[model samples]
Target: MIRGMAHHVGIYTRQSEQRASKSEASTETQWDDCVSGLPHWGLEPQHIERYEDLGISAFKDVDRPDYRRLLADAGAGRINVIVVHYMSRFSRRTAQETYDDLSPLLRNGVRLISVGEGREFHANNLFALFELLFKLQASHEESLNKSLAVRAAKDLEARLGGYTGKAPFGFTLVRETRRTDSGKPVSVKILTPDTEHEAPIVRRIAELADNWITENDPTGSVWKIARTLEKEGHKTRGQRMAKARGDARWDDKTVKRVLADPRIAGFDVESVYGTRKDGTRSTTVAEYRLVRRADGSPVQRYTPIIPAEQWYWIQGWLSDRHPGGNPHWDGKPSGLLSAMKLLFCECGATMTHGGSGFKKHYRCRRRAIKPGQHEGEVTIGAKGIEQHLARRIFAVMRAADDESALAVLAEAANRYAVQRERTVALEVTQERDRLLSERARLRRSREAHHADRERVMLKGGFVDDFARESWGETEQALAERMRSIDARIAEIGDSKAVGLPYEVWLTADTDPTGPGSWWDSADFQTKRAFFRLFFDRVSVSKARRWAGRGFPVETRVTIEWAGGVDLSDRPMVGVA
Candidate 1:
């Protein structure tokens, strides 16, 4: 009989289970020792309540059902005492956890007994509390050492192309026994493609994406594929796992993530750092890349569905087709000065590119950034602002005898060409490609117009003079653009970034009334570079007059020159 007010005794047992049956010795020993001298401690068999958590560890944070139930019952005053074969059987958590959990139980008139240690713990016993804390701390330290050793073993297995985690979606895990250096048996999992169900689906997904993008409909394919997969009655990994949750459908984001996973390509993943402007890699991981083996090839856990070449190409195309370069392309970007971040709102926010196709604009995205704080938005049409800045740059170069503006542009052009092709800013590269597409479309339009003009002439009818003039203007515009593009190509003397050198086309073509100036012959990239040099920041205010109201670009726009270097003594025209 126990000599206290404690009435009910809760016996808790946990086994840090391995594959073999340790339960008989582990659990029964705890029960036998606790109840062996029961009558001597003033207790009967009817007073004992058993709480056993089999195949579970006493380690911190493990979800042990019986253990929790025991604690719950004790807290509810159903059990006034807790008994364990060893103190470690009760918990291998940190001393803090023991103090936090057991202190409350003891304070609430509960007593704890450890049969193996021959110890009785109560609220008033300070030495017993100290002994319990010391033992719990030792147990925690031992578990910590075991965790480190496990991590080391797993790292070794991964290096040898052994799969360590659960198999990804398109594969099933096959685990086998392997012995460690100390002859301890360990389980290593291997991945093999699940052909009947998941593997074929993975291949089909890649094929559909490939065909859709090749057909020039690149943007919305992922969502379409998700819909297609659902229609075909395929389920996602989560959907398969959650048998009760029928509403768990596949979504575009999930599909995109699945498509991008390294596991699908049969390689382990690792996080890599982004490179700084000075060309050095950062310490923190900026993005994930496939883990490569020592020979510079990606480590293979199984046969790959998408080859590395195809995988890289698709990722690059999608990323470029959209807009993000991780700021890796520091010098190369195509389009209006605003696109390169020279444009700013009066509120000091950088303007983001807006609109689509030829209807482009630079818009202040402050509302998106701060939400309720901004009252309205600022917007400037790409055409007016770009043309205004170009005229100013050309004007300064023409008026200055030293030709300092030309020199500035020449340096920028050369500086951009130094980065390799792999590092070319995606925006500029996309711009050049888009322009080429536009030029081809225009050629087709001109061809169709010529055919219609010939039809009227063949009927022995006069094609109107106004119509003829319209054709001529169209033809002339086409020819001028073609010639300018050719000249720009010839002038770009460095890498594809520059196309040619500064010495090739630094000559002045400043006449305002001329058919075309040097500005006309500058490539989109060169134009962007020139603008970057000319302005540190171009501030814009919300247009008071817009749409049908009209463009007040001249008054609403302000400029801050780069390096505080003014390109002209003449007050800038068409700008505030």
Candidate 2:
């Protein structure tokens, strides 16, 4: 022992219970061992400082507070020696990492000692350095091998029809008595149906889904089903319900998850693991198989609440209604003009549904929440706005000719081309593709508008002053757009030509009729799509009521077209 040097000894200890057994060295035990062996190294209790990282893995670079402090002290030449119960207690990091961390401490005149190995690491000793490297490598290998062994055991257990983790909903784990090697009784847990409490709820959910798929029930949508379940005082398993607040209610996502799970069909499912950004494994259900099955035919893991046929049927329904599949709108009709993204308050807040049916009005949602802070709810009768807008749209469609329509289309296409070029130059592939798709959709709409205009032009040459003024305004807007694009290109340091090629004018089949005719025949979904395609937004001013006027007194509504045209000055007349 190197004695009588008046050394300051620092004891470092770490114990991750998750990675080690009960018999392995704990933080408390390691601390005790280090304190007891201080006299052997000619160090007193007064000269010793302890650093402990309890329940923290040595293999991970976690924020070990005490360990970090100890390293700082060593670097500052405050600690002359570092004592650990074992090499692994200090770190189970690879040999290179272990060497790198300790080199600075050793260079600062700190001695490394392990009590369990009864070894002292000397800075100048080649043999001691070799031994330190060997110990670190062994520790790292042990952790790796242990992880592999545990995963293998879990896989084997899963294959043998055993639930390795927590049992899913509608089931409970029951322990069955078994004889051990010494004929002593032990318990083995297995999954069984929880029929009394959870099973009935699962059955009801399956029945509702089946009715929706097979019986064409209108009330069986996921949102409706969730609401129904909540109303019936049925709470989902594992979800805590607050009796006072009534906050814990069934949601659409929960309902969808329950319907999608294959476990309800009497199967055992295993998760496919994925690597996360933090270098941790994230697991998701990948595949399913009938539990306790020997033959190729499907077998029941337990008494299934939902029949196999009904379960399969529900799966087919889900697939059809999925986002990737053909359009099958399952949502309820919001309102007449709700599909039109055309209602906003002067304060730039969106207007949403406020009143009940027939008496319904579009109210500024932000103002409604805090009436004193914001401008009081700017509202307009839904029917009045819809009627006035419909008339205006009809007039425009009827008066437009092929020449005027083509001019508008060309201006819009030029703006889109510039936007696309900027997006591509920035190397934003996703955003560029999205802009291109929108441009394609606009092209199709333009073609339909041109066709309608051509039909009207053939009937009468309606070249009025209003049409001429509109064309002049449109031309001015197009020139401004070109200037704005040029400024943006200059700012981004790109000189690429934003020219629209002939191939970019590809069109699609979208129903093209006079606005009035289209509105008369179009369904709710089609009406919504049409409104979204043409108009960007609508701004509503605060209502002005005269003395002896009714509830809504001449609310001023302004419509903004998608093609940068503003009609704020032309206020639509309100309904009585």
Candidate 3:
């Protein structure tokens, strides 16, 4: 501390190895320089507190923990002087951030000193403050230029079919030896397939994807494939798995990424970068082209996991499964109970499709003693059960043309409206109120600043122009935030009015033939929509019947209608 009022000195230093040269001073050297200079400023060795941020970029206004604590200590009057090796070490962010950080310290009677620059920042030193801001702006521009250069280099490397950054999954980097002009050995890094363990797993995953397409197995979805891999004790390979905090089990996303990667099909892909409205860029695979040698011949970079034909076939299948695709038919219902969630067994396990096409049936998936071993369970044939349920459902729809069904439908619509209000509208209202409150607070702060502008200019330490500019920026930011909040509220309101059941039901009812006919002629998605709209639940139970002296198991289907009607005793025979 220089005087009695200045009792503690905070030393702030930062070094980013990524952004700085190898010859640059480390955090330790910065700390030693600041410590040695503290005594000259009348601050004692015991009063000096060091704050260092290692490997953190100075151009970003991210939450640097020690830097934040240093500010807190200064604001709380625990520290009167802040020391740094240089102003750039303190911050290389935009001029606005530097102003925002140092303004409050100057106002609170704290001094910031830079040992390298041989200067102290105070209210009277306007020239030094401007110089510091100019340096910060220069640093910001330098960072931007460096970023552009790096991106250009990456683009060039990608076009040349060279791997950028880390080698992707299923590939390992190795140095290939080559001779230079002087006949000395040189090494060049190149990617090769990992054959030890990961290559086989990659091949297996590709085979599973191909089988799903060739055999038309909807049950072998991405999620199912991930589960099968986990059951077989397979794990994902990568640095992410090594550093993961939780159980790093294989997931549907991981499996999907591996399957979709073009490199596995022996092609080199170029990444496409798109800039968002916020000025941030995102990279995604643009196209997969065959790798070529210098002689313009195709190069086989790695052994293809799956044939290219099979990979494209799988891609077509995946595209058809997406919403708005050809849903009327893709192939036979991949399973009898493909998307039905209402079917459950007596053992309390949701029934899943078993067996291949035509012979497919729903069976309980619960395990018995061992993990892979399943217990004795009920099974119902797909075609027979669907036929039985369709007839019953058609009868129910015919009966629902009465006044009672209208009343029930009206009640359900009202419940839906109430639920929408509680969930969507309520959230919009709460967020709008919060934003309005913040806007009001900002207005108050602006008014106060205007009322005390003269007093601040005279003794508040900040230059008058900077003070006014910061206040204006703050006002603009608050106004933009409020506009965004308003836009969100309007969007929520519009969404709430769009999806009412009454509107759709009215249109469906006014159709030419009859309600049942319209439902029957509808597409797969429309039929599914009607099913969800009319039925609350469908459960199945096993019943024993004597068929020519042998006891044959039959499945009893129970349908609980959404309009308060319960239909049971619908029997499908010879299923189990």
Candidate lDDT scores, in order, read 0.66, 0.62, 0.62
The digit string of per-residue lDDT tens for model 2 on 156-270 reads 5555455667667677777666555567654555677678767677787877777766665434567767877778777676453233334546777777767766677775554
- CA shift of 510, model 2, Å: 3.2
Q: Candidate 1's C-alpha lDDT?
A: 0.66
RMSD of candidate 3 to the true fold?
A: 25.2
Candidate 3 per-residue lDDT over residues 1-576, each given as its tens digit:
244654687889888753333344688788888888877777664477888888777876566899889988888878888899988888877888778877988877888889888888876678977877787788778887887897886665444434556766777766666555567654545667777757778878877777766666545666777888878877677423464224567777777777766677676554545545665654444334434444222344555666544554555454333221243545444553454555676655677776777887877666664554434566777766655554444444344555544543543443343233323444454565576567677678667767676576678666767777887787787677767766765665532232344333333434322455543465664444445445556666654445654232223665666545433432221121
lDDT of 1 at 24: 51
Q: Where in model 3 is the C-alpha error above 4 Å?
A: 1-6, 9-42, 45-56, 60-78, 95-97, 114-120, 124-131, 163-166, 172-201, 204-256, 260-263, 266-576
Residue range 135-208, candidate 1, lDDT tens digits:
99998888889988989988977654467766666887767777667887667776777776777877777777
- Predicted structure with the largest TM-score when compared to the true one: 1
For model 3, give the 10-residue run with minimal summed lDDT: 567-576
Q: Estimate each model's TM-score.
A: 0.45, 0.40, 0.41
